[model samples]
Target chain A: MQGDFYQLLKEQGYVLGMSGQAGVGQALTTATTILAFKYRDGVLVAGDRRATAGNMVMYDRTDKVLEIDRHSVMAIAGVPATAYEMVRILEHSFKYYRRTQLQELSFEGKLRALSKLLKENVPAALAGTGAVVPIFAGYDAEQESAKIYFYDILGAEFEGVEYAVSGSGSPTIRGILHYVNTWGEQPLSAMSEEQAAVQALRLLTSAAEFDSATGGVNREAGLYPVVKLITPNGVTAMADPHLRSLFESNVSKGS
Target chain B: MYEEPYRWVEAVGNRRQYLDAQFAQGSPVVGVSCDQGILLMTMSKGTPKLYEIYDRLALGGMGHPADLEKLRFTLLEMAHVEGFNRSASDVTGSRLIKYGIAPVVKQAFEEVFKAPFIAKLLLGELGQKAGKDGFLTINYDGVFEEKNRYAVLAASSSVEQRMVEYLRPQSCVSLKDAVDLAIHAWAIGDRAQRHTDDTGGDPKDGKGSSDQPVADSQTLMTHIRQCMQGKSIECVLLDRHVAGTSKYRTLGSGELETLLPKDLSSALT
Candidate 1:
């Protein structure tokens, strides 16, 4: 209606007759398990590498973690197509704001924008065609620390106190993270960056054990979980070699 | 020269003259990209006109204020559409110039119904890769050129010549050095401007600055302070090797004061 890209696409006669309600009639390959929390220095954000369509494992090396901007990341846990679209829109809007305004969006500003986007997709989400929930993690410049936010299907934003998890496998993953972060002598709030990363990998591994939709590291195919560290220094993904070594060590340690 | 139809040639000629007159009045804007990052400086005529086009891109121009505003809105909208159509992270300085900006300026010139933009645009982009920062200057008739080390926009022939001499061998200058160089070049231009009768013709005003005498460094410093006073003189930076969250930022007036040499800075009101 308004001369946006979508409108341009329609005017150019690339018409998909389905209503423009977002993610209608698209094959839904759902990704699972994203957990984020504050660590000693910054935030540790991790996602398991699996996507499924009902009983079929559609993808084994899918990337559920996405970089939203310089200081933030979004981990998706619903229809992969819908989530990807949401991520692209958010990225464009954020970059547009920065370019025109000459400043990064405040942490609260980002939350509001994402919430609005999810709210707009409520139609498709309710119709069971485009349900997308994402966990947001970022280094809050004003607060001077890492913070995480969770969202429901209706886009109600909730701040995570110690840690947060989402996806079909989230219930299992959340339980494991809560236990590891709260029940130990050195819980998540007290863990170093290295320890937090290790715990994230362990949580994903534990989630895959019970949740059929979730997948742990695939050693034969050299596929590993995506783990990112968001700090004042910037975002850095854990290398495959390091992930492999960490997985081996964690598995070798008998429970 | 390409032959033009007789009917519109007079109109085109008149437009050229009008634009040339406009350029004569605008203050010189200068920028440099070095190892430290990129520095863009422009003389403030009152309101701030510089815009950050993206995380690593910023733009400033001197021309008709209305035309500048129109260009800003159009360019920003086009870039937003481009970002939406593709991945945002992939949108870089080169991509924006090659795909979005150049074409739009070209359109303005080629279309008869559209008046040629009477502005000089200076664009600075932080290097996406190591040692790849870029600076670009675009003229009114849609002529665009990329500069490696330094670039100047909206300067007179006399001032441009002086700038060419000052900014030679523009390699690996520190951020503070780059800012200093920009200021010095602008001062030379401003000093030369005082000798000319019509140097201060405000493109915005039908008339424009008084014919002042030549300035020494102290007088030049004073003049710079006076012009920049009470204005939000903005500076855009693209830092390399900095672990900070944002390599791009707009430095405030206080932060800018810290970057100036101690002697010139001490006299700031």
Candidate 2:
């Protein structure tokens, strides 16, 4: 009868799924890694391209650094499906808010939205389900400096003082970040492409060296890219050639 | 042997000075009605080719600066022959301008020779043509449509067109090429935004700004084609029409395209 006037499918009793739980047709949770550090120019986020389901690798080459606003970039890790969907939802929300509210939303406001999305997906995340943990950063127009924020599955948000790391490679990425040599917003108007290229390589290589879950630099494929966000300007991905050149420079310098 | 059949003749006077004929009191300003729906009339045409885009301006009201805010929203959608016509009960009812109907001539000298803006005028005509640009009555008009065509510029509309920013996605094999393409796209986008509707959103808005839900990559390419012409073309007048009746053929639907930032860059080369 609901079908008679567009009723709920719930009464139809259509149940479906496999996996280890009531998976229905829903996607499985595959964890990924996202890491970020603030530079004098702007905030920089780096993410590895691998998403793992349990101990088994599910996908390689997934993007983690995402443009959140005109002046922000979010580095995320955790369930790829949930994180991907969450980012889309946040983008739409940002646009709606930006238009309705003449004032741009705050960085904390962005974190709050992420928290809600993650909270909504918590039930699945707890039951062999997957969750998304993200480390976000953006240039705060009010403060005139880059700010960092973090969020958990239950909508808990925290602002880390120095830097933040989340996802599969968090432990390893965080460990190396201790020796990153730098963190903090600056007076510069922007981060040159070269500087961004260098920073992204540093974060990705740190994970590649210690964490098996994170993929090494992808110099060619356009898909599953990494990006950097500086001040005033939005997030930007160094092109393949530039990334390759940076990697080569790193190798030569290391030797 | 000396005379060529398919030769060009110099157009009489200056086509750029189409609006120079003494605008005394409330006379019509010479300008092209662009699809972007902005006022792009030439203020001066000399060394740099100056054009003023009227973002908002009107002829009525007690003349107060505070009204600018309200007019900003109205100009966002209004244009000539296509300007908004709301009844007295409409949102900004009192701000409506009343005027007479006249055939703003397309310059007699434009014919008998070649116009510097033949291509551009024809391109605009490819989009929309023929509508009221005068005044309307005060009433609680229902859903506005072709049914409500008689309307003039509200006092809130500033004459200067706002500039829009744009981005171009360059499909490049090398990074250098990509950067170059991106920059080229910027130049084109900047030119269009500055020369036309300065108020249009940035090029990044892309399909979002178009009335038609421009989904595929092709429609953007068409938009790019029209943008580069620089002049607001009205009709593609053929030789017979131009010489005899000052007539032109209406461009059918799907006749023109919108170019993306990247598409414009490709054409630049």
**Per-model DockQ against the true two-chain complex:** 0.46, 0.01
Native RMSD of candidate 2 (Å):
20.9
Model 1 lDDT per residue over A1-255, tens place? 222334344454533212234555555778598899888888899999889987889989888889888788999999887788877766766666666554677899888878877887787787777788999998889888889999997889999988899987789877777777667778787788777878888888888888888998788898889999999976788998988887788653542
**lDDT tens digits, residue span A1-255, model 2:** 200100111133411111146455554545555766666566667777776655666767667788755677767776665666566556545533442233456766766767766666677666545556788788778777778888876678888665788866678767656654444243112445566557557766666667777776654554333756556765566666666666777643553
Error of 2 at B25 (Å): 19
Candidate 2 has an interface RMSD (Å) of 16.3
| Candidate 1 C-alpha lDDT tens digits along B1-269 | 22457646666666666677766656777778766788887766566667766556677788888888777766777556666666446656566666666777777765666777777788887876646777877777777778777777744444555565667854546778887777776766655544442554533232223233334567666767766564434566766665533466666767777887665566443
TM-score of each: 0.77, 0.46
The TM-score leader among the candidates is 1
- List the lowest-lDDT window of 10 residues for candidate 1 chain B: B202-211
Docking class of 1: acceptable
